[model samples]
Target: MNINSWNFKKDILILQKELFDSIAPQTAENRTVANSLLLFLKYSAKCLFLKWLCQTVENLK
Candidate 1:
């Protein structure tokens, strides 16, 4: 909820972009594979976060 939290997330995104740019090949080939991998990783992280959030809320109840 804090402004700093938003800024920190933004910074993390920027760093992620930089990492992707560095790892992905410049050629057209394999680009989709790289994107798919990143997408899978993102979704996996979201699922883990949601699980954690649910556990936290239940604990607080």
Candidate 2:
């Protein structure tokens, strides 16, 4: 990819890492909430990506 795309991806990775690092420290009550939301987001993203990939593959076929 071009420098611009690389820069954008780098920024997103940095942000994601920063967010995880910041959320790692959970007191007591916010622990479950934090983990649940994180997992939900992760799974939702995976499902959406897989759906998109399937569509792309079907189109190619």
Q: How well does each candidate superpose onto the true structure, as a TM-score?
A: 0.52, 0.52
lDDT of 1 by residue, 8-45 (tens): 99999999999888776654457877899999999999
- Residue pairs that clash (backbone atoms under 3 angstroms), model 2: none
Q: How close is candidate 2 to the true structure, as a TM-score?
A: 0.52
Clash count for candidate 1 is 0
Tens digits of per-residue lDDT, candidate 2, 1-61, equal 8999999999999999998888776544498888899999999999999999999999999
Worst lDDT run of 10 residues, candidate 2, spans: 20-29
Candidate 2: misplaced stretches above 4 Å?
1-27
Estimate candidate 2's alpha-carbon lDDT, on a 0 to 1 scale: 0.91
Model 1 has an lDDT value of 0.91
